[model samples]
Target: MLGCIWQYFYSSFLRFWLKWFLRHITGKCELQRICAGYKQGALRTSQIGKNCNKIIILTLLRFEEDVVDCVAQIMRHKNISEQKDPMFKVNLQQCLLQISGYNTLFAAVEDLRKEVFDSENEDHEKICGDLLMPSEKLESRITKQWGNIGFQGDDPKTDFRGMGMLGLVNLNNCGCAFQCRYSYAIVGINLTEMAYSLLRSGALKTHFYNTVAGKPEMQNFHQLYCYLAYEFNKFWVDEEPESIMEFNTYREKFHDKVKVYLQEPEVALILKLDAKN
Candidate 1:
């Protein structure tokens, strides 16, 4: 029966259709699981000083049964002929969701190093060295930090835009006491743009920006000014302010105008405008 269904659906068009249907049902949950597991492992390591090996072994053991169940269900009920199968698709979705959740947890824990380690201690050096080691590396720290979890969204022609702003901001604040790769600055700018889009879409309205924007207009304007001051302090860190600065300034101005639409200052404002052309 399975073979018959497979044969019927294995044609190019049918296969493509089935693949997307399955993915749509399963993808979000899968991503959430992976991110959560990642966070749990990192939190355990940071808070309890647990070794990475133990964390990995224990995490796998805990989730092994769920993984097996998902695989079994997929093998038993997956219908190649059907574009949507609740049993197979749902189980697979759960498995992937668990993985994504783990990953998100790991990232949160990893970013807590400032609290976990002494800035001046050699322990900081050893810890980072161990984490960055080839075997210990989890899903490419740089890529993951830049929000590179693989997923295909509605746009068939493009991959889902990864965690851009939130990830980059976390990375910027990591303070790992080493010269990070130069590529990060470039990637950070790109991620900022992606984050801005998400923000505009209202997806991240409850996040950091929203928190700042939550206050009354006068208070929000004050908070925005403070944030702008911090950004200026690090302006030289990226050298070229063409991308980050422009958008940041625009946001600041927009917020100010929101507070008082017709207010004007005496000084001429030098706006480093984004090159939209």
Candidate 2:
């Protein structure tokens, strides 16, 4: 009876550890195979490789602080009129730092433009066609789209959480020469979707390992078996949130629970009580 109880507890502990290891590497719960479709496109394409060459060149040239300041000024003028666009602003700042480290920024921007436009068109022509227009016409379009503006939903001017509008332009100007590749975009989108799933699934608890052991001869076999069974069943259970603000209000709850189980008195007491009762 004692041998069976020890075996059961040991097996349960091993399973818990295995699940924790899986969750850690896989980034929470098992994500759907949403990236399979894009994997071939991402790996087989030469577009990103070609664009990366320009990116490297631009990275080298834009290393100067003065050049970074100049680029930041340009970004501020072109993409950052409002204060609400923090993500755009942050990405622009990071790009400026990357550019300021090397002389490659200019080449990257040129390469990026080349990728975006047909070879038959000049860089100026391509930029004008895609991004710039007559001031009056631009103003008229803005007026029409004013109600559709702001940081919510799928406005092209601020879509993908404003990274599309602000980061794209600022990074391009700062010497990032890569156009959006289909595979890379798909990978990013799929990764975010998986992360959201893990967050919603309450799989966080399964990512922790716990173990208990005691003197073999003194163990109460029947009580130990029941306790191990309870722990094993509880391992897969999703915890309930008491309020909408529980994440914030109970910020340390997981850590605290772990601490209670792992600390001196609690761990021994739990085992002792299980053996006694």
Candidate 3:
């Protein structure tokens, strides 16, 4: 017990000194623009510790370190597909919800989570399309398409457990948009995992706090998901990755690119999808 107490204090002491050192150097870095707002009157001097932690997190995000692999390791014994798991790497839910710019967006995310697909409120035919047509073909088609995307077996419905209608929405968007590439569902799910990591690392709040406009919404989140899905597919092809096993490796690289993009003060979370097409 005494040893644990000493270790705790020692760790806190190191963290306190690290924050002091970072606070002094944040102004000298090229990332000064990101630190500029924290110095303003809106955020108190006492909040300097909080802002310094954010600055440190973003700096870490710019590296190619495998955040997703860390996540996978942490969730190895559990079911990520079945639960949100509080994002073990970062605790940014309250931060995201409390920030004025992100409150509406957080609310929208909450609503999306509470939502489930049903015939009463959803377009059934659109959801199935050629993917789940003719009752007899359901089993084989589900295994072929959904399994290609990492779902366990012949039904994608149960696989959407924790992801809610958001999962179905992303799947539908990608499936319809890119039928030629079997990567649509995979990329969409990959982006979802990316979103989880960014949230877990607290890196996303740093980006969102600076870039988001007044009252961000679920549409904004969906747009970001689509952007990652589309672009990461290109990144995948460019790397000519030999196997899908390289996913987390490439994901970290893609994340580093995003961090590089976020370094600009003028950057916004908005992706110009039409321009890309």
Off by over 4 Å in 2: 1-64, 99-277
Instruction: Output the lDDT of residue 226, model 3.
Output: 67
Better of 1 and 3 by TM-score: 3
Local accuracy of candidate 3 as per-residue lDDT tens digits, 38-106? 432212212432443453333332322433433344235333321433332232221222243353455
Instruction: Indicate which candidate wins on TM-score.
Output: 3
Model number with the top lDDT: 3
- Per-residue alpha-carbon lDDT of candidate 1 for residues 1-277, written as tens digits (9 for 90 to 100): 9998778768647866765675578652322223233333222222222211344334442444544544444344433222433343343334333343334333443333223333244554334334323244434323343222211222111221243223323333432212232323333333334333433442322222213211112222223333333333344354454553364564454444322421221111122323741
TM-score, candidate 3, is 0.51
**Candidate 1, run of 10 with poorest lDDT:** 151-160
> Tens digit of lDDT per residue, candidate 2, span 5-51?
88898777976686568657754321111111112221211122222
Local distance difference test scores for all models: 0.34, 0.31, 0.51
Output the worst ten-in-a-row residue range by lDDT, candidate 2: 209-218
Residue 238 of model 3 has an lDDT of 84
Q: What does candidate 2 score on TM?
A: 0.16
Candidate 1 structure, TM-score to reference: 0.23
Alpha-carbon error at 248 in model 1, in Å? 5.5
TM-scores for all candidates: the values are 0.23, 0.16, 0.51
Alpha-carbon RMSD to native, per candidate: 21.9, 27.7, 14.8
- Which is the winner by TM-score between candidate 1 and candidate 2? 1
